[model samples]
Target chain A: MLNKIKRILIELGGIHRFVMRFFRELVRPPYEFKEIIKQCYEVGWKSLPLISLTGFITGIVFTNQSRPSLAEFGATSWLPALISIAIIRALAPLVTALIASGKVGSQIGAELGSMKVTEQIDAMEVSGTNPFKFLVVSRVLATTITIPILSLYTACVGLLGAYLSVNQHESTSFVVYFSQVFEAVSYLDIFSLVLKAVVFGYTIGIVGCYQGYNSSKGTEGVGKAANWAVVMSMFLIFVEEILIVQIIQGMRT
Target chain B: MVNEREHIDQHTKVITVKGVSKSFGDLDVLRGVDLHLFKGENLVVLGRSGTGKSVLIKLISGLLKPDTGTIEVLGEPVDELDEKALQLLRLKIGFSFQSSALYDSMTVRENLEFPLVRNKRHLSRNEINSEVEDVLDAVGLLHTIGQMPSELSGGQRKRIGIARTLILRPEIMLYDEPTAGLDPITCIEINGLINEVQEKYKTSSIIITHDLACAKSVGDRIVMLLDGSFERGGSFDEIFDTNDERVKPFYDYNFII
Candidate 1:
């Protein structure tokens, strides 16, 4: 068992070195600027509608569900503040990530997964292009930039949805609601939310690419890549959330 | 048998593999395999499944490093080149994958544009457009440019894969079973196109395939790989007519009167 564990560790280290070498090659080279732009559109901007719609529903449902519970404590007036902080700092990015895991992550995994199964990645390398930089890095960078933007957009839409939900019960001005929400929010919450989205983006991008990139067997391997990506990325996102929450709680105290 | 590496060098050959061996754990895929790929020559590599044909071509193209051996592609040792150097070397080589391998998300044009986009070979939109159109014309797929790969016929996709490689104007072309899954008619057409590309571009090619028809039709020289090495290398006719003990059975199995 000990020897087996050692072998696994050695293999993982080799993979780490391999991945890092690819990254080093990626940043230095003849960069694919236009392709990167195209990927940004595909991975980031095009995903806006789906992400935004999900965000709206999440915010509306969350506010409506929490309203009765808060009213029991007669804390209903703090609804705007509560919903605002929750949506912007926690729910928006988290929910957006989940949605992206389903949408963008799967798309990336399937796209690359198919490419690998087809020997297209090998073709790229043979043709004198770094597959990692030309394909993986460009897509990953696109996700990093795009996911946060998508998250911010989601937060905005979600806030609007929460406003509608709150207004359904009691009248409230947009200005007063937004002001109260923003007032209750800290710089830390905003920064941390953005930071978390970045991490989520990285997690999704890396896992999706990793699974597809290393997939060896054949046809069903691509499917396995997409499956493993979703599973691994979701786990990482939740774990990071817990870590982020603990750090935030520590900061507050 | 003499090793092919002794006679080849930077000037005489475009690719040379010396004392190359690769293995997966206990299974040795290639053992002391030595071969030479000369410029503007069509070298068809024939082998049964699991004979390491794919692995050999991949090693030449620097996709997988050999466990122990030296690979010189376009005069530079593949193992010694940095990523940037390797990328530059790759630009000079075009590879057609067995499965067409078109980027599923990208349209045919985007798939063809992939390598060009990296090299930025064309400065303006008109130039890129013209080049893409020219290659598409060559492959007889000017109309399929707008369609996604998923929508195309298998033959159409394979043609697009060829067109993608042509966009680079590579010095060497490596094809991994270009006609493996195609119908007979499609196979003949692809074989014809492969020949046309070789004649027109004057680019050295290494075609890896198990299909004997493809080898007979398109290969200038057929190299049969068996038992982890090249068992036979000769002109297509010599390969067909030779009475060499190992060559006779395979030739008889595939060759028609």
Candidate 2:
């Protein structure tokens, strides 16, 4: 047991060193600015349709389900505040992260995994290119920058969808609904969701790249890398969420 | 420093690999392989399957590090340089992959322009334009310059690969199975282009191939690799005419009449 733990610790230490070196190589000269922009579009902007669809429907479903319970309390007017808190502080970032873990994580993992097997990465190395910095760094940077934007966009659209759903039954104005939402949401709520999204982004990027960069064997390895990327990233996000919620509650107290 | 090392000088040998060996776990690929490349010489390494010819070119290009020994490119110790320094060195060496390895997402122009853009300061836009155009023309793919790799034929893609490598105007050119899978006509076309490019640019070249026709056509000196080492090497005539027991079978396999 002790030996197993020792091996795990050593592996973790090696990965930590590699990540630091990745960051260092990432920022130095011979920037792949074009590649970065291209990846940002490929990984980030392209997925807006799916992200928007999920966000809107989720908010609509949540509000519709909660309406009957609130109606019993004669507090149907509390719908906007209730839905906004649920969507922004809890559902939006977490669900967006889950979706992205499947989408971007698998994409990155498979792409790098294939490159590794085909010796394309080796080609870059021989050509005197920093494969880690040029390939991994650009990807990590793109995901880190874009995921938060996705979370914010999803949260806003989700609230709009909920407001519209609520309007299908209640006769409230858009102004009244938004004011209640703003009033109910505190700075802490905003901070927590944004914080979760950032962590989710980092988790997805790191785990995906790790799987792809270190993959072995052959064609089957690419699929394995993609599969592991999603599985590991989703698991990490949930684990992170648990710790973050506890830390946030402790800070509030 | 850049201009002086742009091409080979008769006085200065370009690439020197001394006692290089590499292995994957228990499988030792290259063992004690040493070779010298002069300025403006075409050196072809020929061998049967699993002979480590490709491994030799890769090590010289700093793609793979040797388990032991030294590789000096343009007098710089390649084994000692960091990743950044290695990339700088790569900018001076151009490689053509057998599979073409063109960025699939990019058009042919973008694929060719990629190394040029990355190494931007070396040449101006007009210079890059003419260089790309000239390279495309030299490879006889001037018409497909706007198409993506996915759109091109197998032969056409390889030609684009040649164009991409030429954009860098490398001092040392490495070809990994440059004509491996093409049709016979395409194979001959690629071989002729390889020779023409070497002469036109005055670039020293190291070509790895199992194709005897390619080896004979492109090689100024032919070296045969076998049993984890070089078995025989000489000028084309010396390699073909010699009747040594080990060397005779190779020519016989090619059905040389």
Candidate 3:
């Protein structure tokens, strides 16, 4: 148990140092603008289909599940507002983050890990290119920029799905459902959602880069790095979710 | 093998690694390794697996820092220099990895163009295209320009890797186990290319390998790295001519003579 705790501490220190380097390199000149744009396309555009499908399913299922509970209280008409609250304020961000943590996180890990083992990263270094700035900084910056946009997209898709589920029973129009959603959510919810997505994205990027950059022992290490990237980022996302939700709640109260 | 140190004052030293030591946890990879490379010469550091041959060149490239002593590349002390200075120094030194280390996602043209685009910065598109074509043509892989690294065979990838490094036109070349996994014919071709690169680029080089034929074919001076530090140095024939058990086994196992 003591050894495990020590190991965790060491890993955390490694991540802290990596993040510090990212911030240090962040302000430095000769920014890799092209690479960052490419990564944004990878992180943002490539993730859309998965995010859309998952968001739609989440919305449909949650609305169906909550219907019986609201009916018991004879408050079935509150379905739109309640579903909107659940999906926008919490569900959308969490689902988007978990999916990205699996897809983008593992990808960055495996890609960088393969490069690390192959000496491609070292090749870049010897070629006089700043591998960290080109690779890690570009990726992290991409995630930070894209995740908020993805989260917003997820919320929109999820609400549409929820509306479909609602429409099946009540024959409600799209106009009424969207108006209810807009009424239920506030500027605070929007701010919190964006903030949570940014934090989650940063966590995923940093964790993935750290694991893969430090990967060793060849092929086995690549697999391990990918696995750890997903697991660690998901864990941190949950922790951050709770903290951010609490802080927002505190501000509201 | 004779412990022969030849005339040193004739040529200028481009890289000098003195009293360098490195350790990884309990393993002592390099211990008091001292070596030098003269300008425009191919020096082969011959060592069996696990003798820290790769670590030595990595140290020279500033990829890894030595725990003790100093490494001077092109008159700049690698250990003492800051990151920016180290980066500038690294541009002057080209390292050809054993794995070739070509960016797997990039096409051969893009891979060759990468170092140039990053370092040279202000070169016009026409100049970039010209330089990329020149290096690819030199490596005889101009046809593979459009193909990704994954599409190329081992020898092709190795040539492209050398071409990528050559794009920067470095003053020094470090080939780490250049002929490690290739067939005998490919090894000979790679050795020929190493010699060609030296002559064409006018670059001092260090080729680390265990292949006797590679060392014999490409080395101007050969040194055997045994048990971390360099044990002997001289002409390939002179270094392997003795009955020393440490040196004799390598010759016997490789050539079986």
Candidate 4:
């Protein structure tokens, strides 16, 4: 048990240094804009279809689930505001992050793990290119920039789903439904959403890169790297979600 | 038993590793190993698997650090240089890995163009293409330039790997198992390529291999690495014409002597 704790602490220390090195390398000259653009396309554009479907489903389900609860209280009119607050402030970012943690995290982990085991990373280093800057920074920046946008898109799609659900019950107009939605969502909720998106995205990128870059030898190590990347990213995102909510609470107070 | 050539000129030495020792955990891979490479010669480090032949080259190329002692390459101490300085030094040294280490995602053309595009931004697209084609032609693999590395055979991949390194025209080439897992015909072809690169590019090289045939074909000087340190150093025949227990097994396995 003591040895297990020691290993965990050592791993955490390594991750801390790896993340610090990422920032140090990030600020250095000769940034890789082309690779960053390529990763943005990969992280954002490629993920759009799945994210859209998820957002729409979450919106419809949340609205349906809450309608009966509000009806019991004779407060069905409050459905849009409630759904909007919940989706934008919490569900949209969380759901989108979870999806990205599975998709993008696994891809980075597996790709880099293969590269590491094959000696391609060493080859890149010897060839006069900083593989960390070329691989890690570009990927992390892509996730950081793209995940917020993806989250915002998910929120908008989710609201549309909610609107559709409300119209099914009472012929509520789209503009009215949206107005009610926006009225309940404050600057703090949106701020919180964006903060969560950035943090979640950065966590996913760093965890995946760290796992892959330092991946052990052989195919088994690559498989473990990809698997752990998803698991760890999701865990960190949930933990960050709770903390960010507390931060928003402090802001409200 | 060591029967090295009597004529040693210190001025021609391109790489000098003195008292270098490296270890991982409790496993000591190289212990107080002293070696050197002269300009414009292929020095083969022959060893069985896990004898740290690849580790020695990696240390020379600045990919790995040693626990103790110094490594000097092209008149600069490898361990002392910072990142930028190390990168600058790396441009002068080309390391061809055992697995070929080709970027599988990239086409042969892009793979060839990669080192150039990164280091020589001043070159035009046409100039880069010309350089890539020229090196590919030299390696006799210009036909495979449009394909990805995965599409190529093991031998083709190895040639492309060498061509990729040769594109930089590095002064010192470190080849790690250049013919480890290939047919005899392809091994002979790779051997010819190594000698061709040595002649055409005028590059000093340290070819690390367990294959005695590869050592005999391209090696101007041969050193056998056993239990982490060099146990023999001389001509291929001189090193192997021995009854020493550590050296005879390699000779017995390869030749009919």
lDDT of each: 0.83, 0.84, 0.92, 0.93
Residue A136 in candidate 3, Cα distance off native in Å: 0.7
DockQ rank, highest first? 3, 4, 1, 2
Cα error, residue A223 of model 2, in Å, equals: 2.2
Report the C-alpha lDDT of model 2 over B127-178, residue by residue, as the tens digit. Answer: 8788889889888888887887789999898888877888788888999999
* Candidate 3 residue-wise lDDT, A1-253, digit = tens: 9999999999888878988999999999899999999999999999999999999999999999999999999987899999989988999889999999899999999999999999999999999999999999999999999989999999999999999999998678899988988999999999999999999999989889988999999999999999999999999999999999999999999
Compute the lDDT of residue B187 as modeled in candidate 4.
100
Candidate 4 pairs with clashing backbones: none
User: Could you give candidate 4's per-residue lDDT for residues A132-251 as a string of tens digits?
Assistant: 999999999999999999999999999998889999996899989989999999999999999999999999999999999999869999999999999999999989999999989999
Candidate 1 regions off by >4 Å? A1-15, A18-26, B1-11, B120-122, B240-248
- Give the number of the best model, judged by DockQ: 3
* TM-score, candidate number 1: 0.89
Candidate 4 docking category? high
Docking class of 2: acceptable
The digit string of per-residue lDDT tens for model 4 on B135-216 reads 9999999999899988999999999999999888899999999998999999999999998998888888899998999998
The candidate with the higher TM-score, 1 or 2, is 2
Estimated TM-score for each candidate: 0.89, 0.91, 0.97, 0.97
Runs of candidate 4 exceeding 4 Å displacement = B1-10
DockQ score of the complex predicted as candidate 3: 0.95
lDDT, candidate 3, B1-257, per-residue tens:
32223422336899999999999989999999999998877889999999999999999999999999899999999999999999999989999999999999998888988999989989999999999999999888899989999899899889999999999999999999999899999998999999888878888899999999999898888999989999899988889889889999999988986
Comparing 1 with 4 on DockQ, the higher-scoring candidate is: 4
